[model samples]
Target: MSSTETATLSVPGANLSYTVRGSGPVLLLIHGGNGDANVYAGIAEHLAERYTVVTYDRRGYSRSKLDNAAKEYSLETHSEDIHRLLTELTCEPAYVFGSSAGAIIGLELACHYPGQIHTLIAHEPPLTHLLSGDEQVHARHIQENLEITAQREGIVPAIRQFATLLGLDQSNGSSGRPNVEQLERLLANMNYFVMREAPAIRRHTLDLETLKTVWNGASMRIVIGGGRASYGTFPYQCAVALARQLGLEIVEFPGNHLGYVHQSQEFAMRLHIALQD
Candidate 1:
């Protein structure tokens, strides 16, 4: 393993925090929601031996800060912030691995600015276009529940719902043991994303038009939801759809939506192999 250091960086609109570790090719590690840069800690360390892994807290999470002058943050701004980070750090176009919402941002960045990214491994983006009418309505309804829970029941329940929605509530999974206490702890800590960033999150919309416009010529691959993940889940469905539209093939990685957490070593090895030339 390589030495690790927690580093802070700033872009024009937001103050960002991340960890720079390892020592080879440049790789940007984007966290989904909840937690801080630590979400990618072990994964980054695993890759650090041969990659300069940059894992950071997006504007509103952990040590990163949102600027007072900014009129709320948008996904475009987040991607731009990352672009700025890459420019500050390396000349080589970096490989990117993003999960869940982070995956969504990675796709946007790759699409909007093709030359900056070498290859993007997007785990899942929760897009509805990959599904049909009934399933689409189901996903929208879930997003609606998140809105309602955050608004009506307070951030705690909303956080719980978010975790449960991602299949994190039951570590062994819905089929095995469920840790109620650990679930609540994560829910409390992750409330900031659900409350402060949820609104901005919904604005992300993907369709055939957006795909053609945004990701047309990008080097992108979607990692579909893996085994043990619910077969009828949104993330899996979304990956399937995005892969089809990109006219690229789908690759399977370890674990479910939270694979990076549930199976860190396996996920890391799979990640290295997936992005390996």
Candidate 2:
């Protein structure tokens, strides 16, 4: 029988709703765009057999609500929240798995609070700053345009544009569509994600010097991951660039960007292998 528990944590500016399942070593899962704790439902279920999986709705998303909804979000604040949660949950270091924007958060945490994470698998972190010249300029342009669209036309249109810009609109190898219920939940959080989180992601820059210093210390293992079908996408390119910077190899996961959602079983199995390696 599967065991589960839910709880709330008071963070800097938000109240986070999180779930814990099964038992063993700690494994923290951070959701990406238009997602909450439930995003890892399938993968968590499988991993929970040997890992105490922890999943949470990030600040200002779903059940995790901000004290000041109008407050601007930043990767620093998000990483701090994760630190606080880990402090409260256990003294031992934990494994972390993050996708997209959440992967960015993991990078921040690894940079700032290295001792808290044992191994961090950051899948498809959209580090636009890794790009160069015209590519960097083009990526920023899209982000700025998306922010403007979200503010002017609203989230629905902004989301469509985001999909098209990321090439997620393509039917082949497209991240499978969310079910109607999941889509509803995503739509509900679109405003927060597009208007708040997306802008934060675009503006944030990684501190390579600090990252290198930490990596040299060998305090924790950092892995960059990309999906097989996510080639040609900005996030995948970003992952590739980051791996080159760190002199690390890119770990390929199953499916596309949202493989953890669409191919949870395979993703879970692959994740286990990745974590071991």
Candidate 3:
């Protein structure tokens, strides 16, 4: 049997909209930056079979709106939103699976509120703390691209830079697939979609200062690098560093950065295994 339901969660005056699919234990699927929880549509629907998949748009995006009179958005607020959503559900400890920036937010959730998560599968989180010289360079490169977008405010170069950071640069001869067209389409849509609400994500990030404040307090699974080729990439390094800091084992899932997109089937399979484990 397959099904989907939409609902609104009232948190501190904000009416947060979310969707639920499937049954069994709850698993909150959080999306990364430049995306809504819709990005997990492919996997969430399937995972719903064995899990109560929860996906929602971050406040200030899509259907969710903020009740608090905060002008700016921060990861701290985002983390609290998740906390309130879970609390309202009477589900204090649900398994959480997040990717990229969403993974960073999940980490924040665990830190901000302890024992609030059963298991968290952080797939290729760009935690940045584990970044080395080359990884730092790539990060700066992507940030530069974003700065360019903020300056010229055009999303094309930024899109290309995104592909580059995800190791999709044509110069690298990474893949035979055609991504330029897809990237172009993504940029065209963003102006009306994600880019329109830039302030929601403006200037916010996961840094050592923030992590140190919460890492020791929160119990979490710090997932990191696995593949032979991914030895020194940002995510892998982040996994290593986070595991060391948290004294947790590095759990390997699937892809490098955008595993859910690049290796969807394998990514989903690994994610399933991770959650099950």
Candidate 4:
């Protein structure tokens, strides 16, 4: 097993809680909505064998505290936080793997600081704008409904709906089930996630024109990944559309949307291969 170390970094508006394991080139894992670093537990353990794996609670999630009153945040803000984190950890460019909304953040990061990343594996970024006319409209409608559900029915009901939206409701939770403590933490985080993070994700637009310029000029490689089990879903469609836009192939991985949580070992191995490529 790899060794583990946890620490906190104070960024401008928040103190970010992060964990490091193993030793090698850095591989930062950015989790999606309602999840903290704990979501990557199994995946980190496996990846740490070959890389210094960094998992962190994004600004308002888990132990990472906001220093002031809650305010609307943007994808660019999260990207800058990560930029500071990468600069603090290593002088060399690092690899990044981001799931769902985290993947959107990674895309934002790559756009602004292309030189800071060696390669970025963006797995299932749910950018509705990437979809076609009706598809995009329908996706946004679902996101709008999710927000309304969160506001009217509270976090639990909204989360249940979100799970269904992401195809996570189909999970038996056999491998992905959180323990009591983790469950409690996740539930707590969902409040901020539903109210703040989800909207940030929804509002973000992938500047494809800018991204093309970056991709053509930078050394950074962006790989889009989609889950095999998640095929035909909203997120998977977004992944496909993103790949099509970027002229990159969509790398299929094990399990569903939350594959890193449920199929961690296999996902890590596939990820290792993707990173090497």
Provide the overall lDDT of each model, using Cα atoms, as 2-decimal numbers: 0.71, 0.87, 0.64, 0.89
Backbone Cα, N, C clashes tallied per candidate: 1, 0, 0, 0
**lDDT leaderboard ranking:** 4, 2, 1, 3
Q: Model 4 over residues 10-42: C-alpha lDDT tens digits?
A: 998999999999999999999888478887999
TM-score of 3: 0.76
Best candidate, lDDT: 4
RMSD of each: 4.5, 3.1, 5.5, 2.1
Error of 1 at 93 (Å): 0.8
For model 3, residues 80-175, the per-residue Cα lDDT tens digits are 989988886644578888766677778778776746787776655665636567766775555556546645856656555555665642221123
Residue-pair clash count for candidate 3: 0
Model 3: pairs clashing at backbone N, Cα or C within 3 Å: none
Reference-based lDDT, residue 165, model 1? 74
Residues 134-200, candidate 2, lDDT per residue (tens digit)? 7778778888888898889988898789778876632212246877876666777787888778878
Task: For candidate 1, write residues 130-163 as lDDT tens digits.
Answer: 6788878887777778878888988767767766
Tell me each candidate's TM-score.
0.85, 0.91, 0.76, 0.94
The alpha-carbon lDDT assigned to residue 172 of candidate 4 equals 25
Candidate 3 yields a Cα-based lDDT of: 0.64
Clashing pairs in 4: none
lDDT of 1 at 81: 78
